[model samples]
Target: MSNRSYSSQPKSVVIVGAGIIGATLGYHISRRAGMTVTLLERDLPGAGASGHSFAWVNGFGKDPRAYHTLNRRSLDMWYRLAHQLDADIGIHYGGEMRWENDPRRATQLRQRVRQIQTWGYPCRLITRAEMLALEPHLHPGDVLAASLSEADIHVETDTFIDVCLRRACEAGAVVYSQTAVTGFVVRDGSIAAVKTVDAEFPCDVVVLASGVQTTELASLAQVQIPQQQSPGIVMKTTPCVEVLHNVAVIHAPAIDEKHQHLHLRQLSDGSLRIGQGTQEGINRDDSQQQADALLDRARAYLPTIGDARAIPTPVGYRPMPLDGFPVLGFTEAVPNLYVALMHSGVTLAPLVGEMATLEIVDDVRVDWFASYRPERFSVRSSG
Candidate 1:
């Protein structure tokens, strides 16, 4: 959208990784008249980050203003899609609860609620008594209190992804599974096509929603992607007679190493997702040492969680982004190339799809030209 303007005409687009972002983008693109779409993934859709997400759809943990707005937009789409595709997706308005014990933090929490409200997010500050009355099983800590944000809703991630893929197919998009894109055929100022191991898929545009593996994927495409990895570890416990009914969390993740926070949510089938530990590191799979460390951390909150699971799962996702927010829009350098990625993929996937749809399908021009342009890294190389 710089010197080159876009016309509101449909075009052929190729998307990489059929996760939430990719699938949604593919679906939306295919829906537009005169548009053709192709989706490529190394595995079946939703088998990667989208499948293993915490799925705790909340705006509290997100950055206020832009991020919170983005989350809410995605959330609205998530709910709408659930009902629109109810047979294939189940959406639950599981209230998200966050509390703080520190006096200073309690005040700050209330201020945050006000900030969120001012920004149009529905939120309310509740007293300890009110909170306990709503969720009685919570440990009555001797300090501040909790804030109930009804905006948070838990959804079946895999199911929604599958339904989205089906929608994409119904809309006439071709999806290629187990296809690893190795290169981008760049001709003139635009991406002409992408090279996969088995064949070449040509398109007028390519939307890059490669998720955590964006760095490597960008490398193959000869594009410099500004990103980093924020590793997360999550575990699930065998169902109890109901240790907790609603999802509860301590509200702050960066308190201290000794402060292990638990975000517990009950799945549809009565299984409970117990999560607390997140750190920075790389591990393709789980290990004995990681399990032991996770257990010790889980014990710090509810000792029974890790003890019940025995071998807790080691969850991992590198919430990749350029700065603190998502990297989006078409690259200034590569005319037909676009990038979209961030931490709350489940919560923000719909919005990402919408924005990308605006750019690729509707031909709406958005200039990240310098600020959010995906090829900013390439500009540095030229410098």
Candidate 2:
């Protein structure tokens, strides 16, 4: 959209959604010379999917070598981004620890560790003693196989998002909270301006990073980006003594046949966020009973988690593409309209922010996003 032939370098860029992706992208674009950046959000930052995410930053579960590599690259880039920000970005750097109680799962875990290792992932199988050494308080019962992915970490999404938005604002970007996107002003085939509830932002380019609502917003421009329903819940707990001392995240084995594995991480405030099944697991129950059950399960391994009560959080709907990969880049029907929607927003924020800035401000198409182009979804006829 900022091509040399198409008017001088997209002087104005309007970004919809102030979530992690939008905040990161806004921060990056605002720093670019001669670009006026504006971020529009219907609610406060991190109030959407980013707020309720497990916030684990890892590539261990990403399948296919290319996808795994994408996550791995971003996971490493976080360190550099934090250094560049030069502020406390709520990044916990203890890596991830997990163990298997069943022989079948142990074999699967062993195979998975080897598979990722071949791709240069910093992960390996560990002995029971090594597991205990990494986490002394963990009472992992009957560990058949254990692992320590030394590169994995989790984030406090709220803290990181707040910091990013503050930095973006400091760099001359205007963030409009409580401003909902009404529609788009299209000229020829490109978005000329983004319309909000009470105002309209004239821009050369518009980006939709509105999480689960991306599909609906993009449709106003006649761009069809389909997404699957991916509602998940991550229950929070009252602040208590720090349970995770060495690791930022821990995946505990399921206690019985009906239950799934549990993953949890402690926030900087000493509150613990626990989730069941998998990162992509579907859970709609935000009832107090469900929260209590999850907290009780967490207590099974970390018995020292004394008096930390569970707090029910609403289910978060992930912006999952039908194929389960990110959908990035501009659309065929709307060249100046960029869509940044994905499930692993926290894991991919750094990479997407930097590379998308290149694609947007510098007008260069990135090869890394070739597989995730928006044209992959058939665009509906504008007529």
Candidate 3:
């Protein structure tokens, strides 16, 4: 923790991207004294990946104890943030239910469960009987093992983003929709203003939270933030009778195969959000076919989506780092420019927002984010 204090003068901040990460940061920063914040979005808030996210808030399957701890901390923060936002962001702490069919994969999952348990995470392998008790709707077809984690939570991603943006505006942060960042004004090796297609917004600091487009935006400042983006499809079905009681179910894919898994969760409005865990890039021609396949899989798992129409929703690129972790913190070469980009943006939003505000407003560097600094990718040249 650094003891440096920020200047007493108000800092003008220009946040590029009005997604959940940027919106949350803007909300926190605007609440502080001596700060003027502006959030710029090419479209409306949550119009990017935030709108299309499966939005399962969980720390499970995250590697490196430090990263998992950070996600868990954010999970804890969500409880307070939901109430503080004073809106029904559709936060359901209904936990997550996951299972594997293959014998080898079952062993791997059990080992992971043990590892997470040692880390004090609330996860445990359950017997088939227990699994059925937890989710009677699931068709337990040759499930080798199953695990239940009460710590997991899911949310309505779009609504949550809306709440974050609304709160940010209420806290005095100005938001500009349909304004795209075209370039950056660099003065003495620091960003002086963010140039948009419509106008230039001068600011003392600029934060890049533009999801998959972060790498592109960072280049305007000659900074590198590498990303491995993959197009993902999320299908939402018309409202139906409740099929799942409380838990979101994830069917793990077999070993050696990347694309053939399904994750389904029920929204508060009785709609099912189904995600095809396959990385089959975007196929405009085959989108309806893909959506049909996802709905078929959901029906196979839980016979509840009977005769329901599936709408191919969101379909955005996941903003993942090249190394499969988050790229956060400020760039060393461009000290005034900060970035917050990650795949699990939904799970990490609140905590990242709070910590980022501390770093930007109070000048207190969070030691935990040392590994996730944007400088990590700056060392490598963009291909």
Candidate 4:
């Protein structure tokens, strides 16, 4: 760890990745007074984990009161952000509906609902009749217990990322796609510029929001940001008739013991994004057979998905920290090198963007991120 004084207000800021977190942070930082923002992406915007995420914006599965509250705050911030963005932003906001079929899971669902309610989450148990009323198209086999997190919603990450980058560009920020960060130009224990394949971008701060590649990129700056392997797959379907009537997303129970739970959400274009198991579930099977099986199981719940074939998508690797929480704030090894790595990028984009801007532009350490600093990671010598 090194101590180097940084400008209270940084003018040249270089963001390493243009995913949801980087895009949102770019937009926020560009809006600040006298800030020149540059977003660097190796691929097209939203081409990484953000584009393939389940995109369920919620605090339901978050444990610990503080983390749950953090997610809950971001969950509500989406509404304000949508209004502020003043564009499509691809927000479907009818809330998330989930049900459990087995008796054991049903009991657990009820308990979980009660637990979040104590934390003041806008969720409650509802009767099966109410579930049908919300989504009449659902042919749920047996709903032993059901709950609705009224504030939860799903986002079309492509649309959101596009809108954010456009806004950032409009605010005089430059975005370079197909640009990979090759290294960092360090001088006097701080990053003086970020080196890409094409050119070096002079900067006062560098944000590592490069998803699964964050660890390796941070290593270039000699900052230790440990990450675990977390590969996931969320298959897509061809356009079909609108299935979900009122709810933004649905978590359907597994049909049998062989399969895991299924979650789905429909896009404005009438196509559905389907995935099995939990949000953090490990799945790398991108074969057509696996895609077809997921769609078939979805058809069992909503028959309106008629003739909609599944489109196999490549497996996406989430930027999951070893501890399974976010790693935010500037690193002690490099004071100006900020790290913004997290798993639930979709859910926490708005909060991370706005709050990270506060730290990056205003030069203040946000207390909300006090528990999630890069210093928590025990640095290992770079290879």
Candidate 3, residue 55: the lDDT equals 85
Q: Which runs of model 1 end up more than 4 angstroms from their true locations?
A: 1-10, 86-88, 239-257, 277-311, 366-371, 375-378, 381-383
Task: Candidate 4: list runs displaced more than 4 Å.
Answer: 1-3, 380-383
Collision count for each candidate, in order? 0, 0, 0, 0
lDDT of 1 by residue, 1-383 (tens): 34333344647788988888898788777877888889999888887777766777767656746666667777777766666554657466746777776777778888988988888787788787876676565554554756888768876677777787788788888889898888888777667789987688887788888888776776665667867766665555555444445543333232454655555665666455545543223444456565555445444444334344534666667657657567787766666677877677878777677677877776666543224556555655554
* Candidate 3 clash pair list: none
RMSD of 2: 1.6
Q: What is the lDDT of residue 180 in candidate 2?
A: 94
| Model 2 misplaced regions, further than 4 Å | 1-5, 379-383
In model 3, what lDDT does residue 163 have?
79
TM of each candidate vs. truth? 0.84, 0.97, 0.91, 0.98
lDDT of each: 0.68, 0.91, 0.81, 0.93
lDDT of model 4 at position 248? 95
lDDT of 3 by residue, 128-169 (tens): 888778778777577788999887888887788787888888
**Residues 277-354, model 4: lDDT tens digits:** 998999989999999999999999999999999987999899999999999999888899999999998999999999
Model number with the top lDDT: 4
lDDT for residue 4 in candidate 2, whole number 0-100: 30
